[model samples]
Target: MAVPGHKLDRMFNPEVVAVVGDKGPGYMWLRNNLPFKEKGGRLYSVQLDEKEIPGIEALGIQNFKSMADIPEPIDYALVAVPRQVSPYVLKDLIANKANGAGFFTSGFAETGEELGVKLQTQLTEMAREASFNLVGPNCMGLYLPKVGVRFNADAPVADDGKIGFLSQSGTHGIMFSLVSAANGMHVSRCASFGNAVVLDVSDYLEYLMLDDETEVIGMYVEGVKNGRRFFETLREACKRKPVIVWKGGQTEAGARATMSHTGSLAAPQAVWDGMMRQCGAITTNNLDETIDVMKLLLNAKRPTGTGMALLAQTGGQSVSITDAFSKAGLRVPRFSDGTYTELGEFFNIVGGSFQNPLDMAGTIQGSMDTLDRILRILDADPNVDAMAMELSAMFAARQWKGKPETLDKTIEEIALHKERSKKPFLVILHPAHEAEYVASIQPKFHAANIPLFQSFERAAAAFARVLGGGGRARTRTGVVGLALETQPR
Candidate 1:
């Protein structure tokens, strides 16, 4: 009994929400729903406890003795009662015809106990028979920022974001939203569906694939109950938009941990990797890589080929940049004869080299005009599909000590050039032990729609993934470029 898309839609953008069994210890679930209340969604509490009723009401939220007592229908409900008492509350929700519900109670099948397993089975039977949209028996569920629905109180409420995320772990889901938001990326919708007994990963994947608001989809999966269905949905999703997957339990030890964590049976590392590659989907190892890859896909221009042009401020940096990109399966080829001849006209050879990985060590530090000319030359080169520049945080700070306006103007000019150029441009700003200084300047790059990486390795890896996955660019209507013509490998 699969839940219909319209029901899921109403659940996601619930006009009325309720919290069942929220207590005073932390009042966590009730507090988590404050975002919905603040955003003009009607919120009610379904609590029978006499002592906790006043505290909940003190927060100005209307409290009802039961779901039936609520004046209106509930689009979504958060159930946080004790595990033993969950079935009763769920029955009440179903009797009231709530659209969907997410259970915060643990000690379900993941506990591996007879009682826990029986309880989960009972709830699954009930949900399936009634066609209820049960999100999770043990997970934080649904962070829809546009509608101000959140699992964590601190999650951002900005609506203008492009990333859609789905995860099996609540911690990863919450962390992804907060971390991505902090990095100037926002999630259109996020679901941490734990022990997905009723609504599984495939359900959400299908929903997001057609979501107009989501441009890119990110997944953090431990495993799936139906492999064929999940991959079918994933393959179709990749065809529509870029799908980045971070498989959690690739190792034996980690796989064992996942069974208890989400009662998932993770696939072998080789099988998972091969499947993702065959689906034309990008793969990442951890949270950082996932975010980095999404940032590149959303912000950077799509590379027509794998040829990269590297620029560095120091000789050592030039060597490292070339090595990093090359090792990541991208080529740092030589420039065309015409490109080299053009550079020879003004490129200072006394302290710099005019090759593919152009070493501008002592040449363009004093002249922004010279740097601009170099960028133009590279941008015009036929062999260069993409360009990357490496700068030290300390160098930037020292160079623009009192001329902050100059730095701003330079960044603006670079952004403009990127727009005009046919190739994609990336920047690698090394912290160089000046992390705070680097962080302070990142917002400028973000504001200018420039993708900035903290290291050459990260930038190169993310770029390689984007190119290797498919050279496609997502537009408001759909995907564009050769990516659509190519079949999954």
Candidate 2:
């Protein structure tokens, strides 16, 4: 196979891969159950010591010690060997011109010892010389839906190409994948560069920016290994794709050791704030929004700025959303009298409630058509930047029950109405036995870029990061299936 200059891509998106590990009980299960090998990806098991694991011989297992012996130049390699032994095996890879590698082995630089640091530095130097991009020095590696490449060592998820995720921690990567699947967000590319040795978060990010399989790029960072490079990547990424980040270890201890993690320079609060302001990067302190922002950007169009109109089945949900948005520096952007009259009683269109939160389109039960029209009108009016949609099960009760298609059609109508106006919209649904409810609405609202948030907090945090205007949002067109439009509704 032709070797591309960038190898991390193969690890994240590989058609052929080799797992260089002992065929133990766990490794065997990983081979059979993990997403990558199951997708009929060309796989080879390079067994060294035990030699004879059941069924290994049939799948083209060779006594071959390294990539040189395989005859086939592999695109990706998962190094799950022991911590002490991994460096030696990785050298063999560098010798053979291996494109990219993922280190599942732990106990490296994280140990914070001099020898460990030396070991990490050596690997980084080797990777540069060999031209092999690396993803994890201590990560679970990457998980991709299309190629079935998963290092999660767990269950399969509904593969929708929406958010392109990158993490500096493997555990966090797994958490995001599982939670994203739970929240009706699908994964296209998920990579965790544990102790990002040669290719840290920024390298994979650069690749994702050019990748067609990604849409929204998300990152989790303990510290950026290279601040200048990271800044450049973040600025570029935010312009094209929405980049949401969660900065880990923000306390004093973390600040002290920032240099050790990624050679990061701990800036004073004012400097850090100024840096983020210059870049388009949306940095978050919250973990939930760390994953949520990517999902939000994946589902929703960018609002014309944070001016919004609130719509809800219940008054309280509206108030909550309103208060939060206002606190986040977003505006309800006062409504016109004609706009208030439109919802009628839904806003109590007659009473004093005719405010930006619109209090009562004055009606108790909102018709699907009425709801759709009202949302579209607010979205259309120049007064609002986006609509704060608070949906409850009660809104769907009288009209949307039994007729499952009714809900779909109603959502479709709302989405279609918002489409022509090209305005961003938000959906806040009450939670209760919601795994399936979220799953059901996913396919419908996907194309429209409306992320149905798991929690309002997640939504608010993510929204603030994007619209804060301090950091630019980046878009990745190279991501393969960003637009998940199932047509003919």
Candidate 3:
């Protein structure tokens, strides 16, 4: 999907950005770590220091003593000034007609103090009065790679992709986005709206629904001001695109953490679950599930049913995978008689069972050609809705091929069959400590858009998530833009 030309221009593609106050480590990191200097926009250091800010002048970053001193109009104002003077800097930004402001300074309502609350309320009123979109009073605002808008220098710089994420926690936002990018789901945009004194979770959720670049929206939400509005927006969004939500706080202790972390009042787990079910939104418990879901949702083809075909390198592993699939609410139907007969023609079926979770140890040991043929048959089988290959190469003594060319050919064959099948194909590389070895060959699977997991249980769990979400309602054929009228200024 293509990004909306207008919204992209205004929100993300800020041609001129002003950073106010002492350029601390965060500000310096953002300035120093910008991925592209000659691309979309320019960043300026706004501070009292008249002396040149080091290393910025060469990278298209200009220095201005104040926002007023800068003659050119600023698209966005990043407030990192001292707490007492932040209000004044914001006033100057408004006077200069800046379209948006992202306050990275803390000491807002999160402190749970009357003064903090008053300060946050004051900032919110200022934004409303000036008709400018406020990101947060105490948060890392935007991390958009397309326009070089990033808050953390250490975060991954991924080429813009389909996933769009929002979080109420700054650290979680950075962590999840980086994790998602490394796992092949490149995030188009990510916002950490801490305290949410101005634009809340609902606003971002609604915005992402219209973002043309966003095919899937993932959120790490602590709380919301208006539950009904949040759920309503979520339900409408789910109808158009997939919305994956991870509610942060469920227990009393966790609720306290949410309150302290973002000054949010987290709802009960039961209430949150009911709301998610009613809205048809996918739910996640922790960060691992969040990443797992995104990896599969972005890459795997949507399935119409839950009939899974499991193939493992060993019989015991196959049994474990079959059990996991069954527990995950997926069907492991017995292959039709024709399928059994077809398989018998390919291999000596003396010891191998022809049912679901077919053990391919003998076929793999015998010939890569036979294993490739079996995969093609399973891929074309109408009874199989999804295919899973659980492998423990460390446990197997058989070598499928001694040369790189032969192995590449085999991988190519498996990839082609998986592609033609138009269903989720999960490859489980087991043994947690042997992940490094698995990682070496993981790219072969990822290159074909197949999901690779560390365990049989995780593979089945991800498949179950895909089935629960119903996947994207429509195939993304073209860019889907959000209506311009409702877009934030």
Best by TM-score: 1
Looking at model 2, report the run of 10 residues with the lowest lDDT sum. Answer: 480-489
Model 1, residue pairs in steric clash: none
TM match of model 1 to true structure: 0.94
The lDDT per prediction is 0.85, 0.65, 0.73
lDDT of 2 by residue, 38-87 (tens): 56777766666654445465544433555577776777777778776777
- Report the lDDT tens digits of candidate 1 across residue range 120-235: 98888889888999989899978889878889989989878789899999999999999898778899989989999899888989888888888999989988777767767777
Candidate 3 lDDT over residue span 1-489, tens digit each: 334554334666577777776454345634633564557566667767644465345555777776788877777667776666777877888888777777888887778888877887788888788877788877888877776677777666666578889998888888987777667667788888888876788888887888888899999998887766776788788987888888888789998998878888877677777667667788888888888787778777776788999997767777898999899899999887778889877664566666787987776664667777787788778888888886665653124224556546656766666677687777777755555655666677666666768777777887788688645343331211111112111
Winner on TM-score between 1 and 3 is 1
**2 against 3, candidate with superior TM-score:** 3
Query: In model 2, what is the error at residue 298, expressed in angstroms?
Result: 2.0
Name the candidate that leads on lDDT. 1
Stronger candidate by lDDT (1 vs 3): 1
Candidate 2 Cα outliers beyond 4 Å, as residue runs:
1-13, 32-35, 55-68, 155-160, 254-270, 341-354, 361-366, 394-406, 432-449, 454-457, 470-489
